[model samples]
Target: MTITTPNNSFNATLQDLIEYPANGINSTVLLKDNNSQYSLFCLAAGTNIDEHTSTRNAVITVIEGSGNLNLEGKDIALTPGVFIFMPANAPHAVQAKENLAFTLALSEHLPAKKGVSQKTIDIVKSTAPVIKQHGKTITTRMYEIMFDTHPEVKSQFDMAAQANGTQHAKLATAVYSYATHIDDLESLKAMVDKIAHRHVATHVLPEQYPIVGECLLKAIKDVLGDAATEEVMTAWAEAYQALAGVFINREQQIYQNAS
Candidate 1:
């Protein structure tokens, strides 16, 4: 069963929602949204759920009865109050040693909060001309630094594009565009959507955003030297995080849709 409220909030007793079928299992979706799914499960004695894998991370809390959970080849006894966390794609199976009831919460990794201060927007916009002039150099240096420091991520990039300088040039243009439209982000919706799709296709993870941001900031400081003042660097860092937040959120939505 599903519950919908006008305010998008509700509270219900888990025991009231549970229904144990004789020699079978029952599941009720308590809530579901883009980021998460909350469900209540009831299993009759002798019931067994075959091993399986899930695309989203999950947590299980045993509310009543007894069971055994085999997670990634490890057997975990499940009794009242037992809680288990299962990472995405980990194989798991469940058997009811007695009539069992549990709560399963599945969720995707959420992106960091996103918002750029007005001061940061102004600073980034004011530096557009300078960034435009040295954008290519900074981006090229950024890729070099990133590859040198985080060699594991090298496979995600297109070596051919990097060798031909096309990738850096493209990033330079994107940087300039962002600076020009800092205050009018709606104008760059198409470009942002295109890049977000490309990032999802390339399997970019939210954790990698900080790595790229670090490398890009270092490259900016190296290329601009004294021109990259403390304030400027700080503003750019904030701007990059805000931009990364956008990409992370969009990519997450795409992943949720695909799943």
Candidate 2:
């Protein structure tokens, strides 16, 4: 639909935007800058785009299904994760073998940023099913362990909410949500920002993260018993710290703004 890049941080999962139209081909402009542009393209089976030339070097990244790229009279097969670097002024065309979808990146690409390790991402995704099934139980136990282990932190929570079990329920949902989205933190940016403001209001200190994190890991172990393997525990710990850093950094900014 409508595409506009506001002068703010932007984030999107490319796969989420891929959609074939009734017209056989659909394209969405994902991001645009003075020198860089990213677009997502979806094509129905047997669809073909006539050859076209770009003044800038464009990288074609196949995201789903199979396809072929005709680049300057040379044909190249396309598949999931395959990348073709087409030079500037080169004429190229795409022909979808099935319901193919791909991303087109144009610009001098910047170096990739570091994120949670692939192993951690895989572990989180694979373990999410099991954890979600027991999320409420684990979070319920987490608060008990936390308040008992450090009663001082209890006052930080709304006693009324805790009395009704809503506090535990919310945290439980958030915990599982974090696990599924650990690889795509940008998608959680708004939620993280809101939580950071709430944390700032409640005077949540950075040092308190370790206490909550420890109790959370222990709670998972206590609830799951033999099911919470060492590898699973390590992945959650890393994910928690990565998320904690997001909050801490945002809270610092909130504090700075207030002062």
TM-score per candidate, chains pooled = 0.59, 0.55
Which residue pairs in candidate 2 have backbone atoms (N, alpha carbon, C) closer than 3 angstroms, thus clashing? none
Tens digits of lDDT, candidate 2, 26-57: 88887775447788889998899877555457
Which ten residues in a row are the worst by lDDT in model 2? 107-116
Summed backbone clashes in each candidate are 0, 0
lDDT score for residue 33 of model 2: 57
Tens-digit lDDT track of model 1 for 32-122: 7666778899999989998766645799999999999999999999999999999865779999999999999988654544568899998
Which segments of candidate 1 are over 4 A away from where they belong?
Answer: 1-114
Using lDDT as the measure, the top candidate is 1
What is residue 138's positional error in candidate 1, in angstroms? 0.4
